[model samples]
Target: MPLSDHEQRLLEQMERALYAEDPKFASALEGTGLRTRTRRAVYGSAAGFVVGLGLLMGGLFLHQQWVSVGGFVLMLAGAVFGVTAWRRIPRLALVDPRTGAPVAKRRKRGGSLVDRMEQRWQHRQEQQGRGGGF
Candidate 1:
């Protein structure tokens, strides 16, 4: 749903107020988008994984337990990095520079934990009204 004109104006006012209150913080936040950061994280992790693989192979060929352990650790860290980046990918949205508000409309991609819980609560209310019980 789109915001009413009044609501939009109110939001813009709030944004201007926030920016006026802390220009430095607002400027820092304007540096990059979530997608850009996510891409960088994914790329960095992939590079780490490649390096880890090389280390692992070198360690294995030389029969060095310590190097092998280090490689395994690196590989594990890379996998964790990649997974976290992937998880955060869906939450990316474009921000409006002028208002510092998200430009993209929210889509129902099952939503966050709070949204899911709110949905469940509404469903339960409807079921109760219908005299259904668990």
Candidate 2:
């Protein structure tokens, strides 16, 4: 579930405290986010694939099996490189550059079904205690 306003404020306070306490550690933890890294990988892979294609075509025209095999290897390597980079792209904590503090990314997955049910049950109990009707 999305954080309540109160929770968000509390989290911001905690982040500020962390930055104030040890900025060096916070900065060290920060990194270029996944977008930049993925873009670089894409560009590199595209270039490699094109070069490999060219080499393959040249080898076919020249009737050199070894050259064609080398080109195929290059293409395979390029694909592997791209896939590895994509898989390894870390989920970076969004950080404020000026303060060198971590920022919270919104949670993609809400609480599990059981957790949600429990929360609703607790909320109902609280409301009943306050004399609120069903």
Candidate 3:
């Protein structure tokens, strides 16, 4: 999954070439991932969670129904924000800064779709061998 330094440099060069050749296209697809923005969103969500926790504790101490309700709302909002940040912030920066292209996420190669299906079928048949019928 890790790219060699030479490959990384090559990819960077290719991307620059592509971008320079057509600024309009490159500009159109520009800025998909802003690190600072992602950081801010994530950090903001964490801060919201801390504040929400405080609100919840205060509401519990006071035993006020309205306070409790408000705290619950705040906690819910914080959780939603935290989830959004955790799920999406990193994904926003899809491109590798060094390569200027989307980084290839590594996944297991089980061969083609049909091959995988056949493998599964073979496995099932083996499991059902002597039994013969479903």
Model 2 has an lDDT value of 0.75
Can you write out model 1's per-residue Cα lDDT over 87-133, one digit (the tens) per residue?
A: 88743224454566656655557879999999999999999999996
Model 1 TM-score, all chains together? 0.46
Q: List model 2 lDDT by residue over 1-134, tens digit each.
A: 97897986787776566667776675566555556778699779878977887789889999998888888888888888888877777654445747564666767555799989999899999999999957
lDDT of 3: 0.69
Please give each candidate's TM-score.
0.46, 0.47, 0.50
lDDT of 3 by residue, 1-134 (tens): 98886996787666666665665566455554554576787788778777777877888898876776777787788778878766764432234544466656566597899999999999889879967657
> Candidate 3, after superposition: displacement of residue 72 in Å?
1.6
Model 3: residue 33 alpha-carbon error in angstroms = 6.2
Tell me how far the alpha carbon of residue 117 in candidate 3 is from the true structure, in angstroms, after superposition: 8.9
Model 1 CA deviation exceeding 4 Å by range: 1-32, 91-134
Q: What clash count goes with each model?
A: 0, 0, 0
Q: lDDT for each of the candidates?
A: 0.76, 0.75, 0.69
Clashing pairs in 2: none
What ranking of all candidate models by TM-score puts the best one first? Answer: 3, 2, 1
Single out the weakest 10-residue window by summed lDDT for candidate 1: 90-99
Each prediction's RMSD over C-alphas, in Å, is 7.6, 7.9, 8.4
TM-score winner among the candidates? 3
